[model samples]
Target: MSVKETAQEVLKKIGGSKNVESVTHCVTRLRFVLRDFSLPNKEEVASIDGVISVIEQGGQYQVVIGNKVSEVYDEVLKELDGSDPTDKIESKAHHKSLFDKFTAMISGIFMPVMGAMAGSGMIKGVLAILTITNLLSEESGTYIILYGLSNAFFYFMPVILGASAAKYFKMDIFVGAVLGAALIYPTFIPFASEGELSFLGISVNMMDYTSTVFPVIVAVWFASKVNMIAEKFMPKDLKFLLVPAIVLLISVPVTLIVIGPIITLLSNVLADAVNAIYNFSPALAGAVIGGPWILMVMFGLHWAFIPIFIANMASQGYDPMMGLLLANQFAMAGATIAVGIKTKNDKLKALSLSTGVTTLFGISEPALYGVLLPNKKPLIAAIIGGSFGGVIAGIANTVQYSFGGSGLLGIPLIINTSGIDNGFYGGIASQIVGFIVGFALTYTWGFKEKSTVDSDDYSGNNTLLNTKINVNDILSGEVVALSEVPDKVFSEGLMGQGLAVIPNDGKVYAPFDGVVTMIFPTKHAIGLTSSDGIELLIHVGVDTVELNGVGFKSFVASDQKISKGDLLLEIDLAVLKQSNFQIITPILITNPDKFSKVSHENNNLILAN
Candidate 1:
């Protein structure tokens, strides 16, 4: 197949150009950020020609194409350049499981800016250490600037979250940003402390929303819904301005009065429940938390633990749960380091080594997705190591004085204000024990290293590009761009790419050797599946399906074999014109993403090889 056709097949297998939000290439992979997870067929993607592997990591759909990925990436971009991609419409049709969907959402939302957030959290720890040690005075200008730098992202967490959430939720970004800002606005902070509040005669349950997760997410969600609903009644000319304006007006009030308080209360209740559990038994709590901690991190279930940890620090003097959970990070990192050393495959070694470095810095998505889960034995070893470490931490009553990442930066956060307290020393000891345990266990028991696939050996099963069109002559009609169609559904290229033809004659012919998949009862359209695996849908006229065969006749039967250029249908153009039905017949490749190119020329659509 030509390079152009290969890109089309690749794009289709990954859920099409519309599903992709962005595309780029690293050394060996075509990285795509898809709007919906369920739309891509992984099996088909893996079977594509020139693809070495498929990896879904940190919400990216990666096609491992070896060294030629950049060439393919360039082609993929060219093929999709003119298409105005849409997201939310495709998202609603996704069929992913709830856990998978939520994992994707969290990964997509946080992965982009996690470095900034983590860096700021680390600085907060630095600030705490500096103040406790008297190295920086609280009243000093140096300390004040550092404190502001450390606190900014956390203080404006709602706005940051809202902007990201809006991108994922398919709403206007600034609208999401403004809504988030309004939630944590300085004026509203005082209102939450008051007894009661009301907005437009509606009772408002005052709740502190600063640094909270669910409120802005809920607000953006409602805004997206409102935007969709408003599109119908909104005038086309005024839609660009009025739809977002109306959505913001409704969503902000609804969020403050209805959504914000409910989610905050839930967060508080969750925090209290977790604290009660921690108070029940420290060792048991550590065991339970550590054993599945990486798994929680993997699916982002650990986000639920964040507010709880903060609450413990706020209500009490310090948080023990976060310290207890710290072993999991070092343990996983150690296990991955062992994998890097033990693996025979060059790619696996590189992946494990880089991911190990990432985990050492408290980012475990790379380690979990790229190594541990794929290598089952190492994951088990890491869990066991973490469990042992957690027991030691719990017994030592490990606690942290300030917020920081769970990697090396955590050590300073747990340091004692006094010389050498058990809480601080024990916390340090637990991590060392966890790393040794994990590295030893994994190095001794090892993972089964799966060698890379020889890309040349596993050739693709289909011959889509090899099959000839049989009728090479230009089609007899007036071929037009998809946007020229009267219906928005067709004009938007939503039903798949092809052309609307104003046919001078009634005849419609089979474009390739295929089996008739269906003949519409009304006879306005015929569906055929090509021998090479293409699907073609030929509609005789716009909305003519409603005519009930009044102005159309289909000559093919379902399951019948068809040859190229065989007469399949005839339409009574005069009857359709008289009845006010459009005679602009549309020849649509219903699964246009399956082809390398769908181009209109001299009254013909040349599906490229």
Candidate 2:
């Protein structure tokens, strides 16, 4: 489907444009705040044409639409009359639980900057590897370039954090960014590095503010609020220019003179606390670090952890948290690949395979949205696997001497040849064992049967028959038996054999006990997997995936077992037909190649057993 149409369909399914309280997009999903979570036709909404999945987490209703989420979000905004998606009524201050609020706040601040953060993090990892291998020197020009590339983000993090914080605060982001940039101005760095002194007799402390965190974020957040207030007083024509000027004039000096030092001190305290805890109990530390890794990934909050990882590496010449995080990512990727291979549905298989590939390359949104979240089992399995691996790494005192990539391929970075006594092999062994165990556990226990049906009956001969009928009868618009459709694959077929009567009503019924495999969010197509291992794809109309699987309801689930003729799915085919959807229902064997001589008769009247 066209991207525009896809966006429109999603908007309609989620209770139309009016139901959306607010909308925003990060790297991979359209994050929506709705007036109510209980929207009409939620099942149907989920079946919408372009949606990957619907998730309710962090007090927001999220639609997973792959990497083009921002483009789709922009299109959605344009359709909403240039409305800013982030402008919503303030949620109750205390409505969310403490933990939820914390996660939400962290996620909102970091999500927007995640893409750049990951790029820089990966560069640093690569540079570390290069330096450790002696492929590059600390004094080399090449090393300088790579180091600069990695360091640039940290050195100017306030700018990025400011923009993100402004979004979170619902204020002028550009203004906030300018305020942040002022905090890191080169002229101030010299004074910041010096001892405490009086700035015009007010007494200011010169501290090393480079690569600092929290202070700039807090400053920008306050600046954004200040900008918002200034914007209200300024004329609309001058608001944009005046608001920033006013906010910066007031905010920058306050941040430099007051807020920066306070926040920097707080950051140090927090860092010290975390370090103390890690020093006291490294295994507990690993669990603490690894446990929330997936949760961090879910909301894109992991970016907040990057600065700490880098800080640890720089100061200690090693960081254990990153090694554990690497194992966690690899475990998830491995589990996803396993599930992709185990799934039977063609569409699901394709999604899983594609997601798996992307995950291996450090892009895990596809896997997270397409497979892990929906299946539940795989997600849990991955978490368990990650925890196990993390604990092992932690117990082994595994540390990455160099910042290496966070995945299976980056294992060599953990080897501390010059510093640690064990030659880094212990960390390597810990990661390998953790990954293997995690994969094995996931492969064995991660895939719960999404369908509750006998696999054999769906694939075996049934108590049905095609007596006799003419293909001309069907062509002549007669209510001929489905067996007369003239396709041997459907007429006398074993895999997807089902009666296809030109029903007087636009209703659909389950052919046997099965779970609804897929009801296209557009409601254009439906797939079912019978308990007897038969996978069925029934396209109600031509180009129905274009419909976004709207107006369809699945009483069953992906791996649910059912009895023969169970009520698996309900669809308003009449609505579909009226809405420009084709009704050429095709019930084909998704796994036809698995069996031999799968036959059907095009000119026969078939009777259900």
Best by lDDT: 1
TM-score between candidate 1 and the true structure: 0.61
- Candidate 1 Cα outliers beyond 4 Å, as residue runs: 1-16, 21-83, 86-93, 303-320, 339-358, 363-375, 399-406, 412-421, 446-609
> lDDT tens digits, residues 1-609, model 2?
777887888887776676676677765678776765555343354566667666666766778778677778888887787556566644333255666655566666766666676677667666766767787788999989888987687678778787778777877777767777777777777775565656557776656555556777778767877876887788999986777788888887777778888877776676677678777877776676664588776764564565566566545666666766656766677778777787675666787778766665556677876677756667777777667767777777777655434565455566553433352555555555545655676678766333211223333344343222232222222233334543322333322443344434444556565677776655545677655555666655444454566766656655556565455456676766676443445455554333432334553322222
The per-prediction CA RMSD against the true structure, in angstroms, equals 16.1, 9.9
TM-score of model 2 relative to the true fold?
Answer: 0.65
lDDT of 1 at 419: 43
Candidate 2, 391: how far from true, in Å?
2.3
User: How does model 2 fare in lDDT?
Assistant: 0.62
TM per candidate comes to: 0.61, 0.65
For candidate 1, lDDT tens digit of each residue in 337-378? 999998786777897888787777776656765577656778
